[model samples]
Target: MNYERQPYRRCGRSGLKLPAISLGLWFHFGQERTLHDQRAIIAKALELGITHLDLADRYGPPLGAAEEAFGTIYRKDLRGLRDEIVVSTKGGNPMWDGPYGAGNSRKHLLATLDRSLKRLGLDHVDIYYLHRDDQETPLEEQVATLDHIVRQGKALYVGVSNFTPERTAEAASLLRELGTPLTVHQPQYSLLRRRIEDGLLAVLEEHGVGCVVYSPLAQGLLTDRYLDGIPAGSRAAGGRFLTASDVKPEVVAFVRTLHDLAAERGQSVAQLALAWALRDPRVTSLLVGASSPEQLEGNVAAVDRLGFTDDELAFIDRTAKEAGVLA
Candidate 1:
């Protein structure tokens, strides 16, 4: 892989520089996919200069399977390239049946991170994130646990995911007090999902916390996959996170308009969506998932036309609002 070809950005104020596009193992790395296929996807990602791999303990359909699958790939193919890779795993979502299966409690976080490390077959990860906030648990305790993980050398940096601006500010303040400032924030940001732009981006920028966004394609709705209609075997068809009911006729019409716009730019809707997310300087990287090598390659090419005209941005905003997809 020619690492120099991929653009790297500073993770907020951190010394680490992450590739602009990272491969996320959140989907299609579970039992539904073959091990060989999963390994091949990862191999293709690395060849495309995608150095960052994101995973979560609860990502797999059978919780924790994704990390286990990544562990196999890491030991077999990526062991020697460890220094060149930035592997991250998150916890704080339910992974088991017991009380400790989830949340930001010190016990859940510590135990899950330890188990994740063992599953990844690595002593330390580049970043460790509290997957979500546990309001029942004191914020102080959660931030302290993250600090503890960094001090113990289990993870090089700490981040938060699915946190609001107020919560992010509080966590950043606590981590800064402990001399381990929050490194990043993982939020869901896309043309369809604009909640982060309301205030989270400002909070991250003010606190110097980098942002790595997920669902940039809005679970494939922002892609050509849904431009015509819900394709068979699609995520929406599976009734998982997205559903057929969620794809209204008006939404498809709006997507067609966006698709036409993408064609004018010589890009796919997926590529346009990726570029749109990257347009914001506060976004350090995009965590994208791919089912095949070709898809991964196409996504990596989104960086080729990252810039957007003011008219394009305005049109997109107006169309999204018209379709009622704006959050």
Candidate 2:
């Protein structure tokens, strides 16, 4: 934990500042991983000045488990240092089998926030997000609910995730009308997934909303973990969300190129991928997850050296186009 940590950035025009590298409890923060492992990783992150910890209602093997685990950590290890951390949680992803259990309806979002608070063992969270756009629900209702969450003091700031450019723009406009500023937009963006670069980035920039992106490593495919083949205990081997079908020969060849580039820079592919994502000035933070302390340490170290030359960025763009991810 003696390594260098990067500077904090303003979340858009908001007065709040977030670390360049944030930790997401999306994976391995559940019953599948030991409590000791979770504590160690989180402890290491805190020691390295990674102040933000991201969570969601549907993050565990079974829903709600990750929040419960976080509650344990909050009460046991991090209770006294609450003010030093930024805790963000999302709802509206459908936790159960009822009509009202999902969507961005005021009923679903408000009720889910209460449950999320209980699970996190907190009176309020720093940020609460609408996990995804509820197409069925009108944009006005979604904005109102988010505004209400802030007004009630249950969440300090409001955000949205997995939303299209059009929807994001609409939500931003609505939130502006209500005087509740949209602080952040969480999306999946990486070298391999440049879909956001098309319009999403422009939408966010136009609205002055910051972005805290996820999957910058593309679930570990952007790393050397799959260079030769799927290791026995790799995420692809688990076959849950990512599977063997994802690790094709073409992907291996592409990863090899990334590996070579990273070697030339004396960094890991994971580090290079993160640096590339952080290059965006609108990207307020990078949400990363790790299964072990070693992985966390290595990933956090990437922040120590985050600069990329003009030639390197151009090369990455060309390689991404060649890989069919960008055009």
Candidate 3:
């Protein structure tokens, strides 16, 4: 892998640097996809210098399938490159049947992490996250649990996902007192969803924490996947994650306008969306999923034209907001 192919940014104020574009095993890394195909996507990502891979215990449709798949692929194809790669995983999502199944209590978090380590066939992961805010668990307990994990050498850094600005600030404060600063915050950000711009971005900036955005393409809404109407096996067509109501008449019109803009810029719709998401320097990385090597390569090409003129940014924002994409 050529490191110069993609740029790297510092995560928060920490010493760790993640790729501008990190591969996420959040989708298409389950039992439904073949191992051969999954390996090919990963191989192409590495070739483009995407050294960070994000995983979670509950990513798969069957839960734990993603980590299990990565274990086999890592042991066979990526064993020698362990030091060069930054692996991340999350817990605190439901993975079993009973009350002991999930949430951010120390007992569950540590046990969940131990199971994750075992599945990844590693002693520890570079970064571990509390998957979501657990209202049932005390804030101090959640923050201290993350610190304890780092102290035990089970996770080098800690982070939180899908959290509100107030909760994130509180967790950051608690972690700071423990001497293990919060490293990153993963939030969904796209032209179709700009909630992070409301308050979370400022919070992370004030706390010196980095942001790694996911769903920058709005789960295919901003991509060419729906240009010809939803295909037979598309996510929207399957009524999972995305639904028919999401593909409204006005939304389609907006996407078509976006396509024209992308074509004028000599980039794919998905590429333009990725570039716009990374326009903010505070966004250290973008986590994307791909089902094929070609798709992954196209995403990496987004870095080729990261610049946007003042007019372009203003137009896109005004148009998106007018079309109700900002909601």
Candidate 4:
């Protein structure tokens, strides 16, 4: 791996540095895909300096299948590169039928972390995140459990995902007291979804926590694929997180405008969206997932044109607002 080609950013106050774009295994890496296909994607990612692979217990058609798939690849191809890679997995999402199968309880967090490590065939993960907030559980209890995980050497750092600014502040303070400071915040952020800009970014900066954002392309909404209506086999056509209703006539028109803007910049709409996501200094990394090596290469190209003028930023903001996709 040519480390010099892949730029790394410091993760907030932590000494660790992550690639500008990290590969996410949240989708398209399950039983439906063969090991050979998964291997190619992973191999391409590492070759491109994307060493941070993000996973969660709740990912995959069947919960935990993604981890198992990655485990197979790790045992066969990535074991030797373990020290050079950053493997992050999250718990606190529903993985089973019972109450203990989900949420931020000590029992659930510890139990899921153990299962994840077993699935990945790893003694420890680089970072373990509490997937979401559990209002029913005490904040102290959740933070303490993460503290315990780090203390036990099961996870090197801790993070929170899908948490509000207020909860993030509380968790950071608690973790600081526990001597395992929060390393990062994983939120849904992109040009189309700018909710983090309201207050989340400020909170993270105040506490010196890095931001690793997901859905930086708004699940392909910011891409050119949706300009001609939801194509077959697209996420919107699948009616999962994205839907036909999401691609209203007006939204399609807005996407066309964004496409034109991207063309003016001599890049694809996807590349422009990714560059926009990384434009934030507070963002430590952008989590991107790909189904093919070609797609992965297209995404990595965004790094080549990350800079944007003040006028371009203002134009994006104005266009996003008119498109009604401003988070």
Each model's lDDT comes to: 0.91, 0.89, 0.92, 0.90
User: Can you write out model 3's per-residue Cα lDDT over 19-124, one digit (the tens) per residue?
Assistant: 9999999788999999999899899989999999999999886799999999989998999999999999999988877887899988899888999999999999
How do all models score by TM-score?
A: 0.98, 0.97, 0.98, 0.98
Residue-level lDDT of model 2, residues 203-247, one tens digit each, is 999998999999989899989999888899888999977999988
Off by over 4 Å in 4: none
Off by over 4 Å in 3: none
Model 4, 1-327: lDDT tens per residue?
657655799999999899999999987888878889999999999889998999999888688889999999999999899999999999999888798988899999999999999999999999899899999999999999999999999999999999999999999999999899999999999876788988999999999999999999888887888887678999888898888898877667777887888899899989998998898889999999999988988998889899999998898778767767665
lDDT of 1: 0.91
Q: Write the per-residue lDDT of candidate 1 for residues 46-88, one digit (tens) a residue.
A: 9989999999988787888899999999999999999999999
Worst ten in a row by lDDT for model 4: 318-327
Give every collision pair in model 1. Answer: none
Q: Is candidate 3 or candidate 4 better by TM-score?
A: 3
> 2 or 4: which has the higher TM-score?
4
- In order of listing, the candidates' clash counts read 0, 0, 0, 0
Q: How far is 57's C-alpha from truth in model 1 (Å)?
A: 0.8
Clash pairs (backbone) in predicted model 2: none
